[model samples]
Target chain A: MKSKKWLFFVILIITTPLLATTIEVCSDCQIKTIKAALSVAKPNDIIKVKKGVYKETNLIIDKSLTIIGENQPTIDGQLKGDIFKIKSDKVVIKGFNIINVGKDFANSNTAIRVQKSNNFEISYNRFENILFAVYIEKSSYGKIINNKIFGNAKTEINSGNGIHLWDSKHILITNNYIEKMRDGIYLEFASNCEVVNNFSTKNVRYGLHFMFSNDNSYLKNKFLSNGAGVAVMFSKRIKMMNNQFLKNWGTASYGLLLKEINDAEIKHNIFEENTIAINVEGSNRIDYENNNFTRNGWALKVRGACYNNVFKKNNFLYNSFDVSWNSKMNDNLFEHNYWSEYSGYDLDKNGVGDVPYRPVKLFSYIVNKTPETIILLRSLFINLVDFSEKVTPVFTPDFLIDNQPQMKPIL
Target chain B: MFKILKYSFYDLIRSRWSFIYLMFYFLLGVVLLFLNNNLSNAIVTLLNVVTVLVPLIGTIFGVMYYYDSKEFTELLLAQPIKRSNIFLGQYFGVAISLSISLIVGLGLPFIYYGLFISDKIFEFLTLIIVGTFLTFIFTAISFFIAISFENKIKGFGIAILVWLLLAVIYDGIFLISLIYFEQYPLDVFSLGAVMLNPIDLARTLMLLKLDISALLGYTGAVFKKFFGTNFGVILSYLILIFWTIIPILGIVWKSNKKDF
Candidate 1:
């Protein structure tokens, strides 16, 4: 009798199919609502929402299901509350247009909020005019991909983020467009994430703002016309590659601001038309290679407390300032970078210049001492001051010179 | 007081699931440190992990500790013991257990460094203290939340929300202010904000201890000018103490007045 019961249980377990049922939701049908369909959704089910405006707020997804919208179905918050609140594992939300997330002074409200969940896929969505377009918190192993997020954030007090992830791990954010938000992409306490192929423009603040995150990779992203390009703070083991930072022109802005970032590999990037290409402070053990800086105000600005950084095989083209250092302590190395301003000749027909290149400008020292004198940038007096300083090596570190400068541009 | 402490500690110890969770965190830290080559890199990564995970663990554990022991707390309340002592004992017990797990998980790596590698004993010690202080601050906040809310889920939710506000949203707001007032000197404003945020204060203190305050540029210089010296460090410590103590005191007051 026991053997027969066990056999029956085994057959029941084996014969049960693990298939997900598909449900369709529309704006005008008898069911007529995404929430109604979700209410009846079982675990591992799929809800397909048709293209129409569904005004809803605080929609919760607790089951391991897939919510896919057709032709970018619009989920308007109606300035009420959060659009979708997800708290389930193995969920996928894709192909939706979300907008008008309510602004709350006390809460970091978002169009889509994923909380304490795992293995989510948020892709191919359009988010606009929201406080925060999509927010992932205490979630892991998620993908935020191919989304268009835009917001008219006039002030930081009233505005939130475009795509914000907090305390989440193993996230992949790729191929997205973000514009005119407080931050295009913001991560805090989020680790082991990969950000790639995103274009962020016209943001009020940073294109990317991440703090206390580790083991992250950013590749092939374009950050343009933002207040600041990117601020990577208190992070380690970051890999940045082949990105373009352009037109992030502001008095206090840069192509990148790295604070307390360590063991980063920054390679094959381009910085064009920014006020400053890279403003590095408190960063260490970074490898910078094969980058191009064109028509920037400052190519590299190294503040104090930076240590053991290496610059190699980079091209600096027509920048007002190549390098600006706040301190004389020279722990970093600059070698084999192509400088368009390099006046040294190669006597032995070698590609390397015979004389070392001094990247630190005399004008930068003068401007640091006298901030009002920055207006004299590109003036003949500044050029003469720079030439005299180069001849006499005053106000700049004597040993802080880039040896092995390339005779010609690398590319 | 003794009974509360004994029961709290015993409860934490008896929970094999929590013990496993702590071990998982420890193993994760160990794996990350092992994979990274640079000591500074490892320290940074470890600090980040601790900052994220410790607060969460502290909040959840604290909330659960209070809610689960409601019956025991009521039983103790029926006795002749003072509520403050009971609260203190429970608080101390919870803080002690979490600190032990954190020290074992995170502090052991630094101990290994001190034993075999460079003599960065002072730095390691400072790091551990900062980590502990951060955990304590969150624990105090969690205590307030646990005492205030009748529903455990709501209390946990509020704690998480507060953590997000303190850890992430504050910085976002500061950045926005800086952008809005780009022409003005934002040093004073930023300094004020930093003073208000205990998390920022702890981070600043840790970075200062690491002697990397200069890399913070104008912000670091402002902090140094205001709080980098011995007196400044003391003031910072006082501020952090106030942040931790005031909330716990508030919880005590609220708990004493409650009709539980």
Candidate 2:
């Protein structure tokens, strides 16, 4: 019995080191480079890289392993191709500062490219001066957290996005600081992504852009001073909550641009000092509730073909124009919102106004036709024209009215 | 001249219309602050009022004060005062008194609401300075009109007409011209047009300070370049001083050659 137990112990001791191994890569170690370490690593192995600059490019990781940087080791791609091409499943990359990936129009150069991978994590890294920070393609069940991406992009045609995802599913992009990129966080043909607690500012294009993506939700993210705030185009069932779209001021800038989007829920967002708070085009069944539009040029500029949308419990405060519709046909419902310009009294002591509020003004329509007419925005002549239009349905839409306008702001 | 200015300033302050005007602005400030409870909103609302109503009141009150005090002016002319002194004194008197009413009336509510400690202090200061400039410009222009036409009806008619032209009709023509020439760049034209009208100039200054000049399109950019920076502010102040000076010079020139 003692001899049999000793044999079992000897067998277990023999097989234990083969299951997993920790390979350390430093200047003095036997595994002198990460490439050499990764070459010998098997599944579930950890390759620890010590603090140094690695001048390598197009480094492909095909084995299921963990790569960790001690003291934030630098990965200088030397303006070559992608730094890390991740193709294996269950790979983890952490604490690497990546810089100077190659710029190629046809290749879509990125600091880290994860393709056809699952259960991957790219976290606690800094990406700078790269074309695309993190490109995730056809990947699922990944988490991108606490990454800072800074790009010095000037225009849309030449610049790339901070975080670009295509055909990815079930990804969480959280707590990333992205600045001066083209589009801060871009998703195309991607779905089921949760973007939370990110700060995207001063981008050349939209801060958070969605094209043909669905079931995506963003919460508590700040889009500040981007070219235009957030653009959700050609998508459905998207939810945006508690985000701040602030100070996107220009002739063509807006807090949120919705084009051909449907069944979206936008709640508790704050739009402040944008040229237009929400520019809606051909969207349907969207619900905008509890959002505050403050000091914008136009609180809501709705174009035609937008139907079944409801704006409720929102505070439109001191915007130059509350709602400007391009067409006279009205199908959207504006209810229970408090407008600072509503001049009606609630005689019945109910919280609603006795007279319905018509938010579109004649000047807004005229400005839509002739953009230069905005120079006459607060002129007395425009006020006379607006007052006349309010008294009689002339140029503005006749049926667009908020019948239950609140006397005070709906908190 | 000093005595004349003092008496006229004191007299205008004691008048019933001055009290009413003061009361009007006081009430507006109180309602905008205490009722709305939003300092920025109140400032916006006050912006509209200051741009439109201040010019109107300046013109009406200047014409009325000139016509109502014709006898007093004639009496001062018969005394030892020079013609330029009498007219300049009265113009300064009306402009200074009206400005005081505006500042004090609006300042009370804003100070009460803690504007001193707020970030909007610069915006409020801009508002005050713009209001004072409007008062001075319109008052000087009205005095020029009054002294230019000896007939009371013509003076009053032409004063209101001048205000209407600057406040409403000039913008109408400006908008029409911009639309008619939409194919061409209107940046220089719009900038020149704004400089020509004191009201538009004031509005542009305030809008730039409020940081919404980006909404003004091409002209907004130009105005921002000419009015958004420190050089712009100094140049605007110089131009505004020029606007005030030109009208006052007209008053001095016209009043000097006239016989009462």
Number of the top-ranking candidate, with TM-score as the measure: 2
In model 2, the runs with Cα more than 4 Å from the true position are A1-19, B1-7, B10-27, B79-81, B151-154, B169-193, B218-239
Tell me how each candidate scores on DockQ against the true complex.
Answer: 0.01, 0.50
Error at B183, model 1, angstroms? 19
Q: A1-411 in candidate 2: lDDT tens per residue?
A: 999999999999999987778899887888777778778988889999899888878878998888999999898988887889899999999999999988895898999999999999999999988999999999999999999999999989988999999999999999999999999999999999999999999999999999999999999999999999999999999999999999988767988999999999999999998988899999999999999999898899888889899999999988888888987666788899999889999999889999999888888787777775665667766787788888887777778889999999888
DockQ, computed on Cα atoms, for candidate 2:
0.50
Query: Interface RMSD in Å per candidate, to 1 decimal?
Result: 15.0, 2.6
Give one digit per residue, the lDDT tens place, for model 1 in B1-260. 77778778777767874577568657765676676534554564555555556676777778778888878888888999998878877877787778777777766665554524665555556657777777787887888888889898899899989887776666656554555665665556766676797777776666555433322333334544664466556777889888888887887898788777
TM-score of 1: 0.60
User: Model 2 chain A — which ten-residue stretch has the worst lDDT?
Assistant: A372-381
- After TM-score superposition, the amount by which residue B254's alpha carbon in candidate 2 deviates from its true location, in angstroms, is 1.4
DockQ of 1: 0.01
For the second chain, the TM-scores of the candidates in order are: 0.90, 0.95
Task: State how far residue B105 of model 2 sits from its true place (Å).
Answer: 2.8
